[model samples]
Target: MGQSFFDEQRDQSLVKAAIVAKYFDAWSRVMIANAARGIRISRLAYIDLFAGPGRYKDGAKSTPLMVLERAIADEALSKLLVPMFNDADPENVASLQSCLDSLPGKERLKNAPLILCSEVGKDAESMFTRARNCPTFSFIDPFGYKGLSRGIIQSVIKNWGCDCVFFFNYSRINAGINNDSVRHHMDALFGSERISRMRAALIDQLPHEREVFVLEELAQALKELGAEYMLPFRFRRPDGSRTSHALVFVTKNPLGYRIMKDIMAGESSTEDQGVPSFEYSPADARCPLLFSLNRPLDTLAGELLSRFSGRTMSMKSIFESHHVGTPFIERNYKAVLGQMEVQGKIVANPPAQSRPMRKGERTFSEKTMVTFPSRAA
Candidate 1:
């Protein structure tokens, strides 16, 4: 939480492990649903791009290895041709081998089709090429953005109809853009100048919505990669001080979106409500559940709006003022704005240049504002 590498690593491992389990459960449920509908997927393959050590330092199990073990033991999933496990760390590779060896059927490890490499992205690409004909799911959980590139993702999804669930470090990306030293790093990670343009636009138009801009840009990139739908979820720390993690699910299938929304809804205990409602309104109605375990969007938005005294404010200013991260802003702020506009509780003003912040020879400005309804009692 304090930006320490060990702390970050530990937090990420826990979040990734939980996410891996969520997907495993979701995938199993999906398979069961398909079978109920008379459709059977005889083969299933999984790929982990950043498969870490096979065991956590605390002796907790590794997510990638756990998934492999479950797949091997599940008669339904084991019927699949084979599954693949990958990691970039040599120690992790050795650890994974040891763990697999200790499993019930050591010799049957071959059936799982495990591969360990120093460069997981390259290996993942090669693995995708080899399994081009089979349905695959790839988990891209890098320590940072360097391990995954837009091109590599495009290749994997395009070459093999693979669906990806990725861990996007919004905080890191935001910090990178805000700081001048890492500006060039953005182009390398995102593969375009558009990120700069969007960053500028966000700083200009909806300064308060900087986090929203990041989420939108990320979702748009996923769309460009051919994923028709995405589900973004945030994980928070226990103290509720900050967002520790964010997960995004990308798939080209509408059914995948429907299923994800349904699964998320069920997980939220929302009682099988149609699609997870995205509706937002200023008036107090039942608070809709946010996908995050920490900061619910409604709570954040309400608190922020109240702080502004329900006055009209620009999106950019709002984002900067609250320090809300991108995932939260994108998923919740827009809906809150939409609800306020509909209820006539607030009105949007024409975009205007934000007050400048001076640093060196440059001036930074933002656009986006909100005004309270004139007739509101």
Candidate 2:
């Protein structure tokens, strides 16, 4: 599966690349801009520990080359971008180095791409202990649950501006939770104490309940490790029969969380009652049958109304405050707010006078200052 993973860019793979590249670009821009004003951030780095071959057999480029392409084109990034690619496979490292060598303007890069071939468990000592010089963005995408550990994440995110996005193989973990053979790996991933609690809790729970439990446990572990924000984007199998894996992004910055949320929301293949599902399900592209009358966003909308009753605030403020534990993104909040507006529940300053429509109805945005009535009218 390692080599075949880069066979061709599938839906989930495409989504992963999109999320990582887009967020990396956004993260670099912010950190660089902040550094200009004498912020603590001095530079930026992009590390892909499980980086596969740079391109697919069909000539599709993977994340490593995609990121280097961005650096080669931008003069500022070329000067500050530290591009590093590593894979346990020697063949992959060779191929990635060759592909990276072909990138135009690679010479302008401040540091040539650092390509490595070594076992992550053996060679990643510095990653688990040493502090990075710059604000590093790490993509730890292991095929299974072998090399990823809580300390690996705990280390990367300790820096002021550092952040990490790792592949969380849920299916592997769910199967390994009780299996004694891989107990140590699971222990390392979630810490021994946390995994013990997780194992005890998983007993007698339904499948759905188990999923929620594990996710909550992960959130708790991330918090304990100093990751203030952890966002998970799940990917279902092609047939949508069962879960496949997920990409979990962790950061200490709320702004990073917000930027990554928008990126993940865009790739969601399904939306429940108008809220992005945050999972890619290729089987049911539109998932019309599943949207049933649950209208999850309606509940969220009401909760917001009650929480900030009679108070005026920007949509941005509402999103920042209300979106931490919820699946609703800024767009989802805007959708529900637009519904409330049309129903006379809330009012928006500088109302939608011009082009604005979603499913032939008006929508809201972050900039629009909105006022919630003292009570639902």
Candidate 3:
């Protein structure tokens, strides 16, 4: 990003930073909590390869600074968190170092924040592909798709507790698909054979359809590499024209996936009849319509009814089992299940009172399991 982007910290970028920082806090806490309970976690690392100037020109802190500050705030986190910030640009590195130097109580962190001025390409990929000594939370944000590759993502999240969040420049990569000059970069990104197929498949497709196809292709490839859970938070252009980029979160743990989905959903601009768009549109600006009568939940309800026709599970279990590749969050599931219980479509019980829910406790919480009607019923 340029100084201009840092000038005011664009709304969309701010949203992106918020999602990452929130997830980092939540994820790191889980690790620390588990270790407190005797789980083995010797160290934790937060790596940002394309770390920009730590503080924006307008005085707001970006991801790198925000992360370090959080570590500084918590004693337990300070003991376990090791943050590394790297940028290919010398100017950014210099600025970021200055900011890091000025951070109050910087030495409280386990490791002095490691700031590097290095390109994120072959050498970096090679380094990350090897076995990691500690569980790391990596954030890969590039101005463009130049330095990012599949191997880096695969390697970062291949371990026991490692997770990755990367900026996917859809607009740029889509345009560069057939451009011969950047073909090598494209090959590195999607693999040579996959890129070829993408070019052929994208022929005569509409812009939006092509965008969906490309995102899915990348997600599918990541899954093939064993990154089981992936969630995307999309950003629209300043003019609200089309998708400009997205922050894609990859993880192997269901808990991590659930955490990110909630954070991203909270950052979303609008909810359609209670279902979030999973997008940040500058035009939307977090505003709600005065009145919305649409019942998109009807569609979700039907899908759930069909899938669980004769089944039963905890709301939490149902969520983990169902919401991998879908946009529906946990709240969405609870809302649908609650409605189904009321309308006699299915039975949602808290597993103890009212017959289950303890006389008056009727919330569809994570522990509350629900039973669906049999096909014969």
Candidate 4:
């Protein structure tokens, strides 16, 4: 029997959405961070190359659409003069249209534009052209490697120099690499005689290591297309058993690299050290939530620390400086403070009372001073 259009492949679909959401969350936090730094993005565009049905059949979260909505609702993002969205699938287009229709007001969506395309390969370039002058973000989440052609990607990045997050299916590609019949297809996708070179490089490596070669080749391809910094993040199932997906971020800007590093570092820190197997349960896992939750806090905390380096920073000062809400500040405050304390990088002092202390009077308030460590030490 031929494969169904809606295959019951829960693992791949769920993992892909989860990973895409992670990058979306990272993008949100980075936008917030940029705003805090007074970096104004007059316009921003989000393009999803292989946008799915917008919602999952398994009740798993919607990714590119959800991400777009979240960003649009964010006050920081709303200030942008333009925000555009694009998707390839007809079902997805209907889904997004329905979603947009349900919004309370059309005025709220005036600046938020969306386009649905029947043919992605032919239309992606034109969409990018429309968003050429803006700082754009394109999410390329294809089932296989075919949805995004080299020429299409080259055109988008060349015109917009946009930041991109791509889902590369290394497992599928690796599985087909040794087949004699598919060599031409692989050559078209990879756009090089370097397939032979890549195969040679992977011959001596382990099965797992071969995946890394695919990722590296993809990264190299993006770099050749003008993305200055490329970072690949691997995502596994909740039980940590096997790598389910790889999220690759390509950016021409230094700040994108900084944000990606912070997000990756946070993910690493939250990961359980010395775990026996990569096998992970979708439930009761930290890494899955790490990408969604802790990564933002990690990025925010790092930014806050960098801004206040060599200076005493109060809790209020930190919150104000970062433009973060009180709840977020409270939840992550101690974690950042604790991390700084462990490194002996911050000092805490009790605030003195203005009046004389009585038996029931609170004599001091908790305050913290953060400072960078001396190089000689």
Candidate 5:
């Protein structure tokens, strides 16, 4: 059967909208905080390469509109924001523009500039390249695996202070990779001839691992392109048996990586390790709730104990490391460390025993160092 129009695919799932909302809120807060820290005054840009018609048939807001909502909510952010929404469909472009015009604070956003472009191919490339000069958050969510070639992603990744949250169309790409007719498209998508070899390697693996293996390779490719942090959020079947697709976030900023990790963790089904799996079916009672904090500290505790066994480090040091994500912040880290100390797993400096005091005293501070008892003396 021929595929339905992209606009009509609204009934598919609401999981994507939830994810976009969480990330958009985080992006605005992070940018505002960064600006407050004297991080050079400049405009913030949001580009949605495959922007839809702002609203779905189910009356849900798409990526572009969600971003617009965030900007409008914060006056400071709205003033510094530059929104560029584009789609290949001219009908979509018109609809998106009309949607913006109808917004409550549409006049306020006018000064910040909202560029709606109806272009594809080179014209689209030119639009993206223009956003390269400033700090930009791009939502490169394409319907299929066609437009976002590796080269295009690389160009955006190379842009100064640019962070991308891309939709990796794993199922589509995996199904089409072996077909001779789709080889050129695959080459363009991956920006390499190594995909064939990569696919061959996956054939011997388990069904689930096949999806993960390809995504890991894609993450590694982006890393080679200079993404300091690469985090992938997996959206799998409700039973957690196979994969659907993944939202791959690539960035050069450590702080951005940390914030995004926390946001994804909050949205994940299991607070285990690595990329979290989430399903947002309204009728499915098994799906994780939207705002639940799924005990990420417990997950981080085991990893921290294992990785930092013998080392003595300050709470600040551990919190500032690249390894720390949304599961916990400085306060949570200190509390966990204190719990470990009480359990005789680690020793704390300025010893908790030294200060005989009230119950639930704050035991670990950024200055206080901790050493695991398991470490070599």
Candidate 6:
């Protein structure tokens, strides 16, 4: 028999909770900063449709409580906070309320004029429709995949400048997409009956490739909903046998994308010194996961070389063009540029200097000129 939905919550992964908390905290900081600069953002609303009992049996806080605490800690966010937590189970709703009532900093949150509520229901479409008017951050994390409908997601995003982070269980899709009942759900989730074509195309492909194709299809569907930028983080079972799911983020704002990329990179539990990557290990796993803080310098360097070979451009031009929402962050470009200089593949030029910079170190600024070397010398 399949695991019970409540049992799934009780057995939640710490790595997943950590990732979600880090991203939401970082995103909140970015939005608060933007508002401080007079961006006129009215409010920061957060809605979690499948919010579990706010705390798991293992004592780790779930996404709903984590987000609420992050907002309460930040004064700017606390003042503009409008949050709603919902679950299909009334018991879970009551548990969430108890968790909220017991949270620290009640005095501060009470003074902030927060608009918060918990509903005992599974009415995600109605809740999403109501969230369409503000600068919202919605979390749609459902076990398996039944509660999230594509039409509701599309309408919410198309109507406002909101951001969403949710899970796409391609493993479930791979198992069920061929079944008639499951195919009906897939069509509703993709907002199209064209999944038959996708299934036909993936029939002879490798398993991993089939997952990739499914993810691409999902990303494309999200793009059609007016999401200008989308990012996906793949997750696997603790044993690393097969991909369990992928966490996807969608937003129309470049800053939102940038912030999320940084958060994802930093929070990734990879030990490599070059590019940041993440892999999940269950709480009961034999081996503990290592968390590292490496930037994607190697990947960024290669991407820069590939895109700018034989071309000269200022740092401002390069950053504006590439760093707005890619895996290569602008802050890490200095390190990448330094590595490129060491390899003689590119030259970072100071203002008004045409000579290739071959010094002890080059500090990249907006005025710095970067040229991809054309000659071997």
Off by over 4 Å in 1: 1-15, 28-42, 106-110, 142-147, 158-161, 178-185, 202-208, 262-377
Compute the lDDT of residue 326 as modeled in candidate 2.
Answer: 79
- Tell me the spans in candidate 4 whose CA falls farther than 4 Å from its real position: 1-42, 58-61, 71-76, 79-89, 117-119, 142-147, 155-161, 179-185, 203-205, 237-241, 264-377
lDDT of 3 by residue, 1-377 (tens): 33443553367668878898999999889999999999887788888886788866667778988898899999999998878777777899999999889999898987787776776766455446432777889988533436766666667888888998978778777888889998877787678888889999999899989989998887776677777888988888776667878888999898999899889889988787677778888767543452145656678888877788788888888887788888888778877887778777876664333543534544678877788777764
Provide the global lDDT of candidate 4 against the true structure: 0.56
Model number with the top TM-score: 3
User: At residue 257, what lDDT does model 6 achieve?
Assistant: 78
Worst 10 residues of 6 by lDDT: 112-121
Better model by TM-score, 1 or 6? 6
Question: How well is each residue in 63-109 modelled by candidate 1, as lDDT tens digits?
Answer: 76677667666656665635666665666777777876776643443
TM-score of each: 0.60, 0.88, 0.89, 0.61, 0.79, 0.79
Residue-level lDDT of model 2, residues 154-263, one tens digit each, is 77789878888978677777888999998877777778988898888888999878887876776677788887888888877766766667788999899999899889
Query: Across residues 74-106, which tens digit of lDDT does each residue of candidate 6 receive?
Result: 777778767766666667777877888888885
lDDT of each candidate versus the true structure? 0.57, 0.78, 0.78, 0.56, 0.66, 0.66
lDDT of 4 by residue, 1-377 (tens): 11221243565456455555665566656765775798765666667665655566665545655665665566666655344445545666777667666644445544665556544554555676777776667777533434456666665565433677776555566776777766655665566566777877877888667766777787776777776766666655445555556677777665555455445434432332211121223543444553343345456556655667667656656644553211232325545665555555665454223423546543322254444433332
Clash count list over all predictions:
19, 0, 4, 11, 1, 0
Task: Report residue 127 deviation for candidate 6 (angstroms).
Answer: 2.2
How well is each residue in 1-377 modelled by candidate 5, as lDDT tens digits? 01222443353334565566677677767777888998874777777776777777667777777777777778888887778777766677787787877877766664444545543466667667666676777777533434556667677777656888877666776786677777766676654557767767876787667776777777777777677777777665545455666788888877777777666666665533233434323223464453245545566667777777778888778778625434444556777777887887777887887744546585566787878656454
